[model samples]
Target: MRIAYRVETVRAAEQELIARLPDGALMQRAAAGLAAATAGMLGRVYGARVVVLAGSGDNGGDALYAGARLARRGAGVSAVLLAPDRAHPDGLAAFLRAGGRVADDPYDVLAAADLVLDGITGIGGHGGLRPDAVPVARAARGSNALVVAVDLPSGIEADSGEVLGEALHADATVTFGAYKPGLLVDPAHAYTGAVRLVDIGLEPHLPSVPDCEALQHADVAQLLPVPTGESDKYRRGVVGIVAGSARYPGAAVLAVAGALHGGAGAVRYVGPAADDVIARFPETLVSAGPPAKAGRVQAWVVGPGLGDAPGVEEVLAADVPVLVDADGLRGLDPAVVRDRAAPTLLTPHAGEAAALLGVSRAEVESARLRSVRELADRYGATVLLKGSTTLVADPGGRAPVRVNPTGTSWLATAGSGDVLSGLAGSLLAAGLTARDAGSVAAYLHGLSARHAANGAPLTASSVASSLTNAWRDVYA
Candidate 1:
């Protein structure tokens, strides 16, 4: 698993580590890692052109010191001082001693640079770039050089993952000490290309719990349901699905398809599309009327094309874990969900999430981390904010938010979310907590989509059918 800490936690840890080390030792550690990363990107440090976009603080110092190291290796290193008087004094002296020259014109050197170290702003800088630095930041991005951001991509809210106003775009980001939340979550995550973490001996000082966590294959393998000798159709767990309408029966088909592969012992589907579902998947237990009349089930999945459905309230009243999605998510009573004895998982895309929050879609998209957490807190349920980056946030903000790393843009096809809703709901039936069910389902859902597509267009059915491959890939 990959864990990310908040800015405050990381800063506290850095300060503690710095106090224990000799004077200037901490900065030297960062500079050495930064220099090594730069060299690796450049391949041949000798006869290469390197430019440092230096600002006014320790972040700028890291760049200047790195530039000095490059200069010693015979790279023609130049510094573009956004704050000439405010640049790191010791770092500047060291750069000059190593034959690094301050650039007469920022644009001139950036145009010919082989690599640009973006140290204009650090984790502390937020609300975008200063007015004076915007043009140079743009020029560096427009250049052919590989832009490597120090710590963060600058102008991103390190804690909230919001990219306000203007921020520099990097080809890669070399972060030190610990991973910050901004590097892992979008929309700031989009600005940070590939991220490389440099250890500066701050791990021992940091807390165990992180702000957010991204699960890997091995982590997910442990969570997958494996049937034991005592396990049967009922013992493995049964998932009840209340989905589809007379108008849209395809949703029922797709949802059942996903649930069938979701490690559930049996799927009891109760809706208007029973005939359609039974026709597609004959093994499904079909029924009419409310969810309570569908026999016993460990969990319920409500609303995926359930237009003006009447079964949502009935499912909510049950003492089993419930997953609400699509049309079922509309007009949800926060008090009802909050007071429930069983866990509830809410899956909503940007538009659906916005409607629930009573905000605009753009607002939710811009601040995804905040939006997911807010939705989770408001309803007192687990929220899976589905988009380019799928985030599952637990209620009350006690545990770290889980980010799905396997998401593919190809999973944007219609009805894909319905498939995800069923898969997650089935996991809920299989005894996974709301948080675990949502995150694990998202991980597999994304991986399955990638397997089905393989760089081509894929339908929601293809994603559902590829679950076996995804499972094998995980177990392998």
Candidate 2:
């Protein structure tokens, strides 16, 4: 699992490490890492033109010292001190001694630079860039040089992942100590192209738990249930799906398609689309009326294409874990969900999430991390906020929010969410917690989309079909 800590936690860890180390030791370590990473990116550092955007903080000192190292290796490095007066005296002297020059015109140096280091602002910066620095940052962006941010890009809320205003977009970000929440979540994540973590000996002092986490293939493999010789259909667990209406039968078929490949031994589908679902997937145990009468199921998935049909209440009333999606999320009451004894998973896209929170879709998109966390706490249910970067946040905010890293935009097709809804519900039936189920489902679903698409546009059915390969990929 890849974990991300908040800025304050990282700061605390850095302080602890710095206290025990020699004076300037911590900063030197950071500078060395930065220089090495920058060198690797440049490939041939000798005679390469490198421009460092230095500010009035330690972040700037790291860049300056890194520039000094590059200069020593025969790179033509120059510093554009955004705050010349407040720049690190020691770092400045080192750069000067190493044959680095301070640029007379920032634009002139930025224009010809092969690489640009954005050290104007660090993780602590808020409310965007200073007025004086905006033009220079914009120029850096407009330049042909590869932009690499120091620690984090300027103007993003490290904890919340919110972009306050105009921010510098980096081709890559070299974050030290640990990963910040902003580096993983979107809005800020979009600004960061590729992120590289440089260890500065801070993890030993940091907390065991992180603010955010993303499951890798190995982690998901451990959570996935495997059957034994004694396992039967019932023993392996059955997932009940309450989806599709007369208006939309494909939703039910796609949902069942995903469930069959979701590692659940059996799938019991209860909806008006029974005939349509049976026609496609005969293995599905189809039923009518409420989900409670759909025989015994370990978990229930309700909502996709429900279209004002009545099943959300029936499924929620069941003692088993329930996952609500699509139409099931329409005008959902918090009190009802909060009062349920069993774990409830609510899967909502940005628009639906906005409606549930009484906020605009734009607000939800802009601050996805905060919105997902708030929704989970408000409904007292686990929330799977579906987007480019899928996030699964459990109720009460105790656990780290799991971010799904695998995905392609091709998964944005119409019935894709329906497939995801069933996949997650099946995992729930297989005995995974709401958080685990959601995150694992998302990971597989995204990998399936990638496999199915393969650079071409894929349909929901194709994604469902690719699940077998995706599951195998995890094991491999």
Displacement of the residue 182 alpha carbon in candidate 2, Å:
0.2
- The residue pairs in collision within model 1 are none
How does each model score on lDDT? 0.94, 0.93
Best-performing candidate as measured by lDDT: 1
- For model 2, residues 1-476, the per-residue Cα lDDT tens digits are 88999988999999999899999999999999999999999999999999999998899989999999999999999999999999989989999999999999999999999999999988899989999999999999999999999999987788888888989999999999899999998988989889999999998999999999999999999999899999998888899999999999899999899899898899999989999999999999998866777799999999999899899998898899999999999989999999999999999999999999999999999999999999999999999999978999997789999999999999989999999999999999989999999999999999999999999999999999999999999999
Off by over 4 Å in 2: none
lDDT, model 1, position 228: 98
Candidate 2 structure, TM-score to reference: 0.99
* Candidate 1 global TM-score: 0.98
lDDT of 1 at 102: 97
Query: Where is model 1 more than 4 Å wrong at Cα?
Result: none
TM-score of each: 0.98, 0.99
Residue-level lDDT of model 1, residues 121-183, one tens digit each, is 988998999999999999999999999999999788888889998999999999998888888
